[model samples]
Target chain A: MIRSITQKKTEEELDQLLTGIARIFIIGCGTCVTMTHTGGTPEVTEIKEKLLKKGKLVTGDLVLPVACDNLTAEVLHENRSKIDLADGLLILTCAFGVQTIARQVKKTTIPGLDTLFIGKETGLGQFDEICTQCGSCILGETGGVCPVTSCHKGLVNGPCGGTKNGKCEIDEKKDCAWTLIYNRLKDLNRLDLMKRYQKPKNFQREPRPGKYWLTPT
Target chain B: MVSLFKKALESKKFVVTSEVAPPKGTNLEKIKHHIELLKNKVDGINITDHQSSVMRYPSLGGALLVKEMGGEPILQMTCRDRNRLALQADLLFAYSRGISNVLCLTGDSILMGDHKEAKGVFDMDSSQLVATIRKLEKGKDLGGNDLDGAVSFCAGAIVTPEANPLEPQLIKFEKKVEAGAEFIQTQAIYDLDLFKHFMEYAEQFPVKVLAGVILLTSAQMARFMNKNVAGVNVPQNLIDELSTAPKGRAIEKGIEIAGRMIKKIRKQKLCTGVHIMAIGREELVPEIMSAAELG
Candidate 1:
């Protein structure tokens, strides 16, 4: 499963953080991060209420779509006076969004959430992080289930023999990665393909940190 | 002519109703189980029309499934997605197929659902939809156009008693009653004190009111709704009670809480009936009624 940083800070933690700060400004993201419930207008409002209870003056709050995008700078520019008046900035966005806003703002900025990896909604109100984005998409040979993405220890080959009755060694309830692979391949009638020796994954082909790409016009 | 639902309200005995959300896919076993469980317990089963703007198996199909299963279905119609023409056509088709009850709603905003890019066709709000139903009963269309055959329904509308600005909801409630709405179902009410206060003011009106009883899953679920869901306040004490339950016993706790509310409402005879919304946990309806000692 993908490991995303789950922000479990309670209202009490927020109150303690904003105790001395007289003026606070809140910034929220509107894209994938916000939809995932890490940061949004609603979450920002909740933080604002906590700060108010702690006697901190919440100057203003705004949600920008794709806070990491250049458009966020324009939104901040439009609300510059509010941003400038604040003693501290609380950014309720992904880590990237927080960094982008911090780079643009002249005031002191802090992140309200630690960014986790990409996840998928398993059910209503239930999210399971399933991808670390390891700079590769290896669904072609793996039957759509990424062993590198899902396994807790990121084991690429067969199970380490620690698995008991298809459950992972790390967690009893979680499925064993090799077991899932066997089942998926068996269902697809491609069990013979698992016997072949596969080449080691090329690290250079994956998306590395500091790498940037722009679409051709 | 006034709706038949208004005529049914003349009876002194209270009525019972429940809602059933059709599965997203073609799974019929769960839906069938719910229908069977609620068959004798409720006077009608309201099949919701794409609740929360999320697409699912069609409401008409679900209603038909209920009809086939020998259950009376109150087909819920929302004006958010369908235009007037489609609305009128569907109503006519429903009436032709012998479906009776119709609950009109303005529906949830399109921005809240998975399909954000989908355009909302709010051709008519709930009030206008009620008025249109009345017009159909008179053998006429919304555009003052004539129809080949007349149609009738036990038309109903929804009200939120816990609205902070109570006057606007009251105004809309009155307008719906005026627009030939014979019955009204309210939004989920967890705070009885507030509900009693709302009833004190609402009782003056002539229409029959059914208090909505939404089954709580957990105290955290209740708290989450209170924090996120608009116009719903589950109260802090209730939240604490739900949160403090022994692990895996939260559902039982929720049922107990719902039963307590139902018993109080029934003992007080506050409203005409209760509309139980168990959400996905419809199997607990019998348990809830049994807990309240209703049946």
Candidate 2:
């Protein structure tokens, strides 16, 4: 539920996508994006306003719940006239949502936001991009702070000597992943837990195309 | 007798208020039940205007319901969807209906709502809306057009006390007061220490301020909102406390935490009042108030 702001395409990039299109329709996803305040209706409206300010012939915009789910096809079917009236579709959703719209519509499709992996909020309006979808989650151990995902250097066993005053070598304000893990374990009075060295993470199922299962089917 | 809110502010006693989100559909039974539960417990009820850009029953309609139910209603208005003409007309209509208190907001982005195809008419931001309200009070429209009759309101606006680069928010705070805002309601404040720091600067101003208190349902819920909701920050320690509660008892724990915060806020007199946003859990408002000994 960490509602990280998705990286958006610059106006120059958007201008290139809509270069010659006479009319463009923007679509936003409501379920996840709206709740996160990232790709929801507000971002779509802001995008539409920005495009209008750029003199683009933007036709209109629409937001659908679970744009990657089957419901999007139904929404597309319902709003087909508006979608068909436009020369191209600008989608403000995750990568899955963009692909879903592409599969459902015949018009040219473009992604307004670059999909990033799930992140956790560290503070207000601040997020730490963790879990590169390494295909595995090891939150049970390590007291919830992911050394593999959160550490910029990805140190699994211990903090590198580069860590100074608990801050990461890569970024000054960011806490070293190992340092945070150490402090958290210490607070729980379980500092000895670090003696159980975890092996280097396996990449077989991560950063690669693979199938996942909720239950054996 | 004068309004309880006016009296409380005049006496410098910490007052308590709460918000009621109108149901999306026409069903008013639940809303009415909530109003009855909170009528004597709180000083006023804020009727949110399509909060988070989601379309629901109008705030004006909810305010009317509050009026009929014998509760003072603070009508919230956002400028995102309405033009000045519509806004002014709505203000006039609200005044005629005996809705005197108002909280002006710039509004959430329309793109955040279910209706993405809806057009946004940001003819004015919150500051301009406050200015517009002032102009109407002066018997003039925004364009110097004279009005047939002047309208009066107990005008207020919102301030995000936790906004980073606090200068801009502070500047806007001063601008709102300059535009004739009589009161200010802050965004949901979790860290009172941070709020104290904000008040250090705010105490110099001449307006009554209200601290917004949002009820936390669960640790996971708090974490979710901290991650997702803008301008809301739930400290990790508070989340941990929420997580430690046994199943089905988290709501009670939340009420306890809110009660504690309210007690501290009242004891310190950090602000003129407290505006509680329980999200959809309006029933627990009285519990928090009673726990804080407000009644």
Candidate 3:
């Protein structure tokens, strides 16, 4: 599950940001961002209408079914003329999607959305952080709970003697991630997994500018 | 050699220790004073590892200083800042430096600290950290590779007797015991009845339990902790006492509250001993012990 986040900026703010550029191309993602209503056909349509009402030209608009996929390159190429018609582009997608599309096209891309964190959809219109994207994965040792994201202190070795009534020390609303992990492991009878001391994470694996590409088949 | 605190754990008598959060900067004068004052009064001095995820002088360095100052040092190791490699190396260093006692804890989240963006390397949970210490004692690393020499430790872990939904905390506590934690220093406790209930189950395990006592300075402090700090509860009476303290004597009232808690824990034989967390009030430990009749 992907976490689709919305920025606090409004239509007026977006209009203010596009001061000079009359003709604009708007792009949104159908997968993650669409779910958040921040980057979808509806959102793109809304922005296009607002721009038209502001007397600016709405050159083109497309909500790529999936913007972060390898196929984004092909999609950008397919929509090249529609995109080239605009003076600039407004990307209502995550950083990953914006950068992915930007690399394929040479047009100046304006990020209309704020990229939040990697998280899971907790409920309808609700999301919570689940993974930190730390280079190394240790959920096996933690009984499938991601302490990196769960603990307020993000303590991997956890609970930190600060939890009260199974809730976090810092946030009373949240369950203590360690306590949850412990209880989960106990229920699974896999508490033995918690016995192994995890060495420090090899952050080098998830260094900044992280990129990966599988060899062509 | 086994540390004196280790001996106390093995013995039936109650054990007493206190925390000394190392300075944020290089100024060691304050910690040095706390250590010197507490050296003879308590069984061990726990050097916290960035206590609330805020960066500070290393616990390993503080443990070494405790050793130098003639205090039994319990080096607290958290999996927050260091990975397994750094953790193992620090353990080896602690053992080599003759700092024997260890308190294994899953450290506080880095978000709670000054550095909000720092990545947490919870490579190991507290249970794993405790088990790792055992592995080191067996002269081997986690990879099953033999070490240059064997290390001996008086290892311990923390427990929250005051935890709501106490079942999960108990589960973790039991896991810590199975992972080789010989002693447990509980989170700060105020309600004695709650601790008594926790101890009823805790006694079945083969581990020592030290009730944690955090010195309450004021009603505001108590309210702040209740709201902000997890696993901590300051009874309304105690808060009222702190509020009514004459002028600047609030600290004295706090001292009395801590001393009184220690006295009751000892009087009731609550568990093993008391682990006093005076927060920044380390100098008042001797007085606390005196009032508790521990001196």
Q: Which candidate leads in lDDT? A: 3
Backbone clash numbers for all candidates listed: 7, 4, 18
Backbone clash pairs for candidate 2 read A41-B111, A41-B112, A42-B111, A42-B112
TM per candidate: 0.57, 0.59, 0.82
Highest TM-score scorer: 3
lDDT of 3 at B172: 72
- The chain B TM-scores of all candidates, as shown, are 0.96, 0.96, 0.98
Name the weakest run of 10 consecutive residues (lDDT summed) in model 2 chain A.
A155-164
Off by over 4 Å in 2: A1-217, B1-4
Q: Which of the two, 1 or 2, has more TM-score?
A: 2
List candidate 3 segments past 4 Å from native. A1-25, A41-60, A69-75, A85-90, A99-103, A106-122, A129-160, A177-217
> Each model's C-alpha lDDT?
0.77, 0.78, 0.84
Which is better, 1 or 3, measured by DockQ? 3
By lDDT, the candidates rank as: 3, 2, 1
Candidate 1: tens digits of C-alpha lDDT, residues A179-202:
677678778977554433333344
Best by DockQ: 3
Query: After aligning candidate 3 to the native by TM-score, how far in Å is the CA of B121 from where it should be?
Result: 1.7
DockQ for the candidates, in order: 0.01, 0.02, 0.38
Which interface RMSD does candidate 1 score? 27.1
Per-residue accuracy of model 1 over B100-214 as CA lDDT, tens digit each:
8899887765655667778876656677788889989999987778899999888888888876445435655776787778889988898898999988988888778999998
* Alpha-carbon DockQ of candidate 2: 0.02
Alpha carbon lDDT at B288, candidate 2: 86
TM-score order, best first, reads 3, 2, 1
